[model samples]
Target: MLSLAAESWMLYGIACVVLICRYVSRWLQLGSVSRYQIEDYIMISVFGFYTTLLVTMNIVVHYPTNLIQPKDVPNLTPELVAARIYGSKIVVIVEQTMIMTIWGCKLSLLYFYHKLTFGLVQEWAVKIVAAYTCITWLLMEVLYFLVWCRPFTEYWAVPTDNIQCTAATHHLLTNFIFNVSSDLFIMCIPLPLLIRSKLPFAKKLMLCLLFSLGIFVILCAVLNKYNSFKHYNNAMWTYWYIRETSTAVYTANVPMCWALVRRIFNLRAFNSPDRNGIAKLPETPNIDDVPATIGGGEFRKQTTTPQHIMSAE
Candidate 1:
């Protein structure tokens, strides 16, 4: 029978593969209105790079040993000590990727705000909030690495009983605090603007529904952080693995899916060009389609494009 941990690990991997295909399909569709933005490209690269490192580390560390080592045999040098060292490095990389992916999602939300919100103040506010979020993430990661880099073995092993090492609690809490803050920031940034937008009732409802999807990601982060703090056993290895992989895979995949689904459903808020400055009114009417007079008075019949018609009161 499969254990819960093993099942979660398997499901996590499958989710990653599913999400990767989803992203690639969007790139290939030629019909998805969603062009991969800079944030999207960064997310894909980070996900791919970190996943490659993780798989490589898994093979290097776990492949050489058989299911059992003979009890009579003495210890021998493992396939490569490099795997442990590199695995440690990859753990750090994966963490960075998670942090980057968070910021990327936040920026994508801000970009959505930029595209959807019309006011200059709202645009500048999103930009400033994005900048602050990015800077703080970078600083925290840099500080984390610096703390981890001292003697390095401090990360995975206890070098000396006498040497006091930085508590993992400190790092974990710092990370958790910032991640939750960033998530709340992403969730809150566009609310006021969205509430005040000129979109019709239906479109406004759709926009809220779409934005709420990010809440799923925030929940993932919270659960993953809780597991990270609580896990301390061999069985919990699976917890760590699932948490890392799921947080990476699901968060990355969901936004791409949202964009595609919105495009397909023809959500007027997402599709209407007038909402994004891709439309304008024409000053001149075609002579072939002239005015219609009513009650002996002359009046020009209103001519509106499909986009304009959709942006109704």
Candidate 2:
């Protein structure tokens, strides 16, 4: 039987491929394998966490396993029933862990966005947004699980038995709402600053297109919330959840793939034009004279003064 676990693993492979391309292209751009940026480390670590989430989901419950029809419950072996209960418990934990996986991807994107911005004012603004988003994500993840199933073990038990447990629709809706909104906000945060950049019309259009790719991530987040309607049905939930979560990772990695695109095309896409209609060569900017703009978006000429001859007359 096809299972969400199988599908998620497939997406994991795809994510790894994209990440490999991102890293290789980055190194190629720098003309060296030794140099690494802070975002590179964070992305690698996020991929590690993503891998763990995929692996854990499959191992804990064999969640993708086909179930015997309910009519056959009376004929089931005691061992099989016990196994199902154990798997159910594991599912609870897996759901909780999934939050961490999603948040890791979001945080990685936020850091990447922060790295791309310049100016002390802009940098702090992005940092503050990042910090507030982090706090909101943490709180959402915590409350979604705990408040929804106080004495957390009850989530698994209540699914099959009539034990007291919180209603899930509201919680699911709340979580999905937050997820979609956050995804949209993060993707939109850079638009104003980018729109105001001094880049040429074509460059600005291309950059916007590059960042606008996150609109796919926003779609994934919306669909993710839509699928929560099936929260009580594992088969339906797994079917949609796999796509939703995988898409989260997929969208997160797509923008990073720009490095590979640039490398493959041998395009100095970010370089600005010089006065002679040639690409400006890179130069070290003096702190005092440098504009608050980042290099790829603007090419301010280095200030030079001609020497004046002085003679005693």
Candidate 3:
């Protein structure tokens, strides 16, 4: 548990650093916080829920919980039972915040894709994926709160024999299905556009790699569920929970940090303007209105950043 707490805080710290870099990149690119897009604001809210998740997970670790082996149930005194109940209550908050944090990341990515595909044929795909993501989230919530455990109190009921209430097997399964499927849908949104763009093969691969960071998040989700099922009695799932959320936060924010990377390193390849004083896509002349950066889409008249180009790829 000590190690788990340490790992959680460490991952949270890294996530905070990346988030700061994301916003700084946005500010430098857009020239002001007022010009920040919807995805930027969504990430801020996601981080708020992520912080809550970290605090609640630590509280769960500090207190004993009903999620223990059957052997431990025989020795449960009133004080231990009460502590377990308290921890179980905290588990409810933890689950909610975890869902919020993960789904918030999904929503943030969807918004970014919406802007990325705007004024293009791929915009319709974004809309469809956005609807699917939202619907799955709602279904997962309904299954968790209403279907899985009856009357909502079984989740914290001490001395209960229901594994569904104690171990949350049903919740985990449904969440796995919805979460992974939605992430795949969201990931597919930008790939086709990147492929269709006439950018050089190397740049296309780089952009695809950036958008494909969600693959790590998806892998973490799978490993999280696998460990939870394999070591249900040992609380091994807690570590993966931290890892999955941190990876999601990282994947969602990293693509936006390119501006900061370019600024700090003085990289001229992507940000250099052409002789006509406009951002140039080497061979793609048909889509010059499309923004080049993954996250920033403030293509207003006042903006003169040469990073804006034909396509995100």
Scored by lDDT, the top model is: 3
How many clashes in each candidate? 0, 0, 0
User: Candidate 3, residue 117: CA error in Å?
Assistant: 0.6
Model 1, 1-313: lDDT tens per residue?
5655455547657767756655654553334427655645655655664455455434333322111224412443453334444444445544555555555556655654444332334456667667777777777776676763455555533222212122345566677777677767766655654455444556557655655666666676677667655752223433444455455455445544543444555543232346556622222221101000110011111322333221110
State how far residue 127 of model 1 sits from its true place (Å). Answer: 1.8
lDDT of each: 0.48, 0.57, 0.79
Please identify model 3 stretches exceeding 4 Å from their true place.
Answer: 68-74, 269-313
lDDT of 2 by residue, 80-187 (tens): 666665766656555655666677777877776665553323557667777767877777767766665566666554234322232255566766766766777777
Q: Least accurate stretch of 10 residues (summed lDDT) in model 3?
A: 294-303
Candidate 2 ranges with C-alpha deviation above 4 Å: 1-6, 29-35, 56-81, 158-167, 230-234, 272-313
Candidate 3 lDDT score at position 260: 82
Q: After superposition, how far is residue 72 of candidate 1 from its true place, in Å?
A: 20
TM agreement with the true structure for every prediction: 0.61, 0.74, 0.87
Clashing pairs in 2: none
Please tell me which predicted candidate would have the highest TM-score against the true structure: 3
Candidate 2 at residue 49, lDDT?
63
Of the two candidates 1 and 2, the one with more favorable lDDT, higher being better, is 2
